[model samples]
Target: MPEGLTDDGLAAMLVRGLRPTRVTLVEHDPRWADRFGARAAELRRVLGERARLVEHVGSTSVPGLAAKPIVDIVVGIDDPDDEQAYLPDLEAIGYDLRVRESQHRCLRAGDPDEPVNLHCYPPEHAETRKYLVFRDRLRSSPEDRERYESVKRDLAQREWRDVNFYAEAKGPVIREILARGGWTD
Candidate 1:
């Protein structure tokens, strides 16, 4: 949500208060990395230099971890507020706008069972860096990775109005891991 709001639809995009998102998890699939590579490459090819920080992120990016089957990717741009710079291209490639916030915009593709979450931000945005740091930390430390997965498994069993709530519930552990990984924000 950029400054000077107008559309209530955009405001509600982050919180629909509609149907609940199913909290599902599956065993780590080896092909996830391949999917990420293809998507990243396609983004780079389409967006050229504008796609600066294309990266595989989130739980699915971590190997040997059970996750929601969605390939989450973070793509850094010159300015997330400038939708004209990247939105059209993203939508052209089948990624629909999913979440829009003050300094970020997310797009998605595929169905609920198999989806790709594309998060966008400016090159130096804090959240962009955080995603990379958290992902790398999980990748290198099996202990931390196990801890994260265990929490996700437990939380997935509980009902939620949306996946957003489930994500919020993991905030404590996320901050803890960020601390251990030398990330402070």
Candidate 2:
């Protein structure tokens, strides 16, 4: 676990159930970029200067990779744990708080056909940059991208007790890609 975040703290982050469910990965959608762009614009309009950085990360951000069809965005804020600063600001624009971790928060919104997840983190958070780097690496390196896609495609076929478990299953592959991608400037 991350510093200051205990095991209990991690478990408490879930705002809802972790029932068994399967995620279906779909073909790369060209419109995901536009969807992310629109959301980023809306977030900027609402948060203004407080929105330090808004980026499109996750499988959807990669051009040819298959994904869950949800747009995952990372917003760098002054402080993620300070809900008063951005939680309501984002909620005002229709985002619902889903996860509140030690140094991060996740908000979800959008129609059922295409949901959006906003990950909020401090401007200096390593996870925020980690997301961007992983995304960029996949975008540029077809070899790693294909390898990730294969793993995701295989994992997507299994019925997961929790979506987090599915994510955990991808750890080895993600780490391999991240190793090739590097972690620092």
Best by TM-score: 2
Candidate 1: clashing pairs of residues:
1-101
TM-score of 2: 0.92
lDDT of 1 at 134: 93
The lDDT for every candidate, in the order shown, is: 0.84, 0.86
How much lDDT does candidate 2 score? 0.86
Per-residue lDDT for 77-149 in model 2, tens only? Answer: 8888889987887888789988877788888999999899999988778888788889989999999999999
Runs of candidate 1 with Cα error greater than 4 angstroms are 1-11, 15-17, 111-113
Extract clashing residue pairs from model 2: none
Candidate 1 yields a Cα-based lDDT of: 0.84
